[model samples]
Target: MSTTLILLILCSVMLSSIAQIVLKTGMSNPGVLNAVQSGVAMQMITTISTNLYVIGGLTLYFASAAVWLLVLARVDVSFAYPFVGLGFVVTMLLAFFINGEVLSTAKVIGTLCIALGVAIMAQG
Candidate 1:
């Protein structure tokens, strides 16, 4: 792959990963969703609309989708889709460190398998 293609794919993955982290962070605030439970869905919408992190995350998600579309146009979907697995790895690591989530043995093995699968697919 060309350096440009590599960068584009990286951007898509990183943007997606970052978006997940940002959304998670935004939702971490207390009462972020309590309004829904209280039957006041409008409050939930208001909270989401006012949350900068959530808004930023959504923007990044759209950016990722744009790059992902370019990637799809340049390569076979089957060949490129495995790369999406990289996002899973990125998200899991971020979740472990940023969210203080446990890094279970199964998760590590699963992520490794995803990497291996991507590599195997790319080699074909």
Candidate 2:
């Protein structure tokens, strides 16, 4: 693959990772959603208006989509899909800092596996 293609894949992966973190942050706040008994229409409006996290998530999602489109223009889907795994590593790392989430030994092992897989795929 060309350098440009690799860079584009990496950019898309980073943007996707950032978007996941932003969305998680937005959802972590209280008052994000009410019980379903709150009436569907009222709940829908409140869900849209009050939930900043959903808004932020959608924005990041769209941004990621744009980056993915650009990446697809330059590389095959098989090559690009492996890079999405980077988002998992990024999200796990972000969770530690943002939400005080702990990484278990298994998770660390899994993440290492993912990194190795991506590295091998990139070499192909």
Candidate 3:
């Protein structure tokens, strides 16, 4: 891939990672689901609306969509799809670190396999 394409892919991956983090933060709020369950969907909506992290996450999600569109304009779908694997790797790491989620040996091996597959595809 050309440098421009590589940069675009990196930006998309980073933006996607940031979006996940922000969404996680928004979800971390203790009363988030309770507000929804209490028939306070509007209040939940308002809460998310005022939350900088959630708003930033939403913005980054849209921005990533736009960037991905631009990337598709310049690259083949085959190439672009592999780039999404980077997002998967990032999300897995974030889940482990940010959410205190456990990564079993089996899961680690699976993720390594995915990374290897993506790497092979990128090399090809």
Best by TM-score: 1
User: Which portions of model 3 show Cα errors greater than 4 Å?
Assistant: none
For residues 1-124, could you state the per-residue lDDT of candidate 1 as single tens digits? Answer: 7778868887899999999999888877666756556667789899877888889899999999999999988978887788889999999999998889999999999999998888898786
Q: Which portions of model 2 show Cα errors greater than 4 Å?
A: 33-41
- Model 1 score (lDDT): 0.87
* Candidate 3 weakest lDDT stretch, 10 residues: 29-38
Which tens-of-lDDT digit does each residue in 1-124 have in candidate 2? 7888788787877777778887777655555444234558876566655677768777778888898899888778997898898888988998888778999999999998999899898787
Error of 3 at 62 (Å): 1.6
* Lowest-sum lDDT 10-residue window in model 1: 30-39
RMSD of 2: 2.2
Greater-lDDT candidate between 2 and 3: 3
lDDT tens readout by residue for model 3, 18-105: 7998888886776665665667778988776877778888999999988988898998989778878878778889888988878989
| lDDT scores in order | 0.87, 0.79, 0.83
Taking every candidate in turn, the Cα RMSD to the unseen true structure, in Å, is: 1.4, 2.2, 1.8
Shift of residue 93 alpha carbon in model 3, Å: 1.5
